[model samples]
Target: MTILYMLLSSLEITDISEQELELIEPLESKFPIDKIKVTVCCQSSFICFRFYVLSSRYKWMTYKEAATARTAIGCGLIHHGILKGSCIALYFINRPEWLIVDHACAVYSLISVPLYDTLGPDAVKYIINHADLKAVFCMPLTLNSLLSILSEIPSLRLIVVVGGMENEVPLLPSSTSVQVVTYSQLLSQGRSNLHPFCQPKPDDVATVCYTSGTTGTPKGVVLTHGNLIANASGFTISVKFNLSDVYISNLPLAHIFERFDHISLAHFGVAVGFYQGDTMKLIDDFADKETPSKGVFCKSNFKHVCRAEYI
Candidate 1:
């Protein structure tokens, strides 16, 4: 059967065998699937997101905690009627909750479709309608933009707001049929009603990333679990990463480059830090006086760097 399957493909690699292909697994292969707490037994925090309102502060989560959150969020998604294999949209800036929700989708075999704010409302509406997203996990800033187009997205049933709602939930149109819930509320519901994990095959679609629409209407690029793992593997071969290394996630998560970077870095158990939403303060974040630096910076197209003292 494997020989026949390989022969049917357009390209053939005589050196590679069917057994090698079968060995390919999802991101969980590097990370673990079961015993989430024990597998990522790192006591130190693995992910942190900064908040700068009046002062600078960071919210940290250990790998164990992140794994737990992902599981709960995945179960919560199921409880909210977002079945496995459904397409969910992630509309937000770079943040910890974004990764949490994305990891949840990965664990449950749901296809995550990322929506960038720079894409504008028209493009966002087009992608939402085009992908037929079942649900959207967005921050409070992007909530209004999504709500404005609620009438257009027929497939969207749930709106899981990441941050707590600062103001009262906006009154929805009488004709709309969407339910809004806070991130914490969803987590609580999921905790009470835990669902079994639905593992995905290598060939299963992991995400459907959209083009920037600079030339024309955005087009969705379907990527499978195998494709992602392969991309990460290739990246690691080119760039070495260490478990003690820290990665600052200032790039937009919606971009495929940044997405692949995150996957590869996480595979190496590298800690990740998210900058405050404001781009103007990005330099300030790098020059944080409270945190010491090792004076080593890796220059990249995206300016990937980390403060060694953060770890």
Candidate 2:
């Protein structure tokens, strides 16, 4: 029983390996110096990782590709162009910057509906029915409260759950009337089928963002890719951000505020320090004690304190 329990508990990945753990166990009379390892507590947990700029694997990309493809697509939702269709409805718990860009460029020309994460099921149902959303591109939802509302959202034709397969959400319904896809699948279709130069243009209507009116029904706001590019670029040039800055992230990506900064950072090749929850919390914990070695706070919590060379 003890062995089984130990094995089960051992699955948690510490950023440090057995080799580093050994060095850590013996209290060295010496101070924590070059490559010193320690744990830091962060927004909802503890995380661990050695401090270094070039050690991580995730790479920063450039701007030229930003206009060609969806700014960011997950593992399953990859198909583009004709497959994406037009006059679609995008339901996001977060801001849909990429969708708007596509809409602006005449790529997807989607109508976006924003769902409030804190609302009860009843409110969600009301918005879906009222919006006449034809297709929804969204991150996976917990408790399937989203799926329950689907039956009531008549205009909904497709559901796109972004990212990979190991997600906790349940398998989408077996019904053929409404289909579910992952983000990568959409990108795959585009990569394999679309003409390399045939991507959405810069001047088209990128997306329709519906405002959540507290007193009345929601109103849709038309936005273009040009708008997002201009907005994101303003931050990029003014913020002095560079390709090497790393930011620790955890904010819902479905808002324009996040998109504004994401475009700036992505264009510059900023290394994003994504936490696997607690495992990545250590980096921030360490950042708190020392001078910020280019600290990036929660998605919304961040702001430009200095331009590119702030660190």
Error of 1 at 221 (Å): 0.4
Candidate 2 lDDT over 1-311, as tens digits, reads: 01111111222234533532232212123212111121111121111123234343212221222222342231112243223324443444333233323222232233334454455566556666665555555556533666776767766666655432435446665773666656555555544543311133335555555444565665666665556655654554456644446554434334556545544444444534443234345455434443333423222221111111223
TM-score of each: 0.78, 0.51
lDDT for 264 (candidate 2): 49
Worst 10 residues of 2 by lDDT: 1-10
What candidate 2 gets wrong by more than 4 Å, as runs, is: 1-116, 119-123, 126-132, 163-176, 183-203, 211-217, 249-251, 274-311
- What Cα-based lDDT does every candidate model obtain? 0.67, 0.40
Query: What is the TM-score of candidate 1?
Result: 0.78
Query: What number of clashing residue pairs does each candidate have, in the order they appear?
Result: 0, 33
